[model samples]
Target: MEDCGEHEGTSELKLGTTIIAVEFDGGVVMGSDSRVSAKEAVVNRVMNKLSQVHDKIYCALSGSAADAQTMAEIINYHLDVHSIEVGEDPLVHSAATLVKNMSYKYKEELSAHLIVGGWDRKAGGQVYATLNGILTRQPFAVGGSGSFYIYGYVDAEYKADMSREECQEFVINSLSLAMGRDGSSGGVAYLVTIDSETVEEKCILPAELPTFYDPDTIES
Candidate 1:
């Protein structure tokens, strides 16, 4: 894969990262697995990738971890700058535009990609989102895989209406499978979800066929 930015030549990326957004009667819910790689796992197994940046604004990010962090920094700066410039944080609208511009501009160097979730107030307030994602309608995003095992398993039961737990289980397992078959992805799995008030974090161990298949086997 091409280097997105500081994460240059970084071959080991995550596999089966699935971000699912559901709009409920009150607000929206978003979820993602916590797996960074199958072969290598960093400490702090959990990351708050999803955030309730504002009362109505929530964000979830995925992609090259480093690139994702950079983009998030840029986003945080952009929001602050624009907020001071306009006195009101246009998080949702601005985030959508911000991500699009970043992705379009740094598609080659920045190791960044994203799946954003949030809500905006046009009149009554509505949840809005954008995704320049690698996966179209599939349940998961497999970045580092041989395309045989990862895709095969993810596509087998990728339900758009899956629950948060189900999605997490499927993605964590998929990462394990990819790490076993592919050289690019393996390690541990992470999960983050956000709502109107707060964000939650969960990490799981890879499901490889060895002495390491327990869900409690997390590194970070």
Candidate 2:
């Protein structure tokens, strides 16, 4: 479950899902698989992991569902206040820094990792990864247990000059591969694309997911 902390209660939902974000030519694309589980049982199949923290900024969550969701909410509220104080839109870096500080301060108690990405007038499009008291701005970021299976693929396939459409396809393809291989990641795929003028949200259902291989042609 992606190094999740021990649940204090049996009823707590554990989210061991895949979350990723990619910076494209004009903006950022963030996505996640919609499956929440508790121990060996699946509790929810359509949970949204992409959260809007500000106007164009969003975060993709992984690890304990409760911890991640609570953290996102707190960050959202703070960013709103910060924007009001500054009399301008908040930068994506500021939102990510808030997440990093909180995550680091509560590292002992919280088991969550997040990818913060969005568009700002100053930076255009940016992607930042935060976890284990560390924060880095990258062209792309992936998290959760499913990430272990796709590191090599992402490293090999990612391109710095990818267009918006290519980035979207890349996220969907990567999620499909992970969902096929990781038992914890499944159900529909939720994606959000943020640019200077628009925030686009889309969903890819299980039946509509792209097929990558023929089972009969594969070796177990």
Q: What's each prediction's TM-score?
A: 0.54, 0.92
Top-lDDT structure, candidate number: 2
- Residue-level lDDT tens digits of model 2 in 51-112: 99999999998988888889999999999999999999999999999999999999888878
Per-candidate local distance difference test: 0.50, 0.89
Q: Name the TM-score of candidate 2.
A: 0.92
Candidate 1: worst 10 consecutive residues by lDDT? 133-142
Least accurate 10 contiguous residues by lDDT in model 2: 1-10
- Per-residue alpha-carbon lDDT of model 1 for 36-142, expressed as tens digits? 44234343344544544444555555556667767777777777787788887575656657777777777666654455555444422223443442222222343
| Model 1 stretches astray by more than 4 angstroms | 1-66, 83-93, 118-149, 206-220
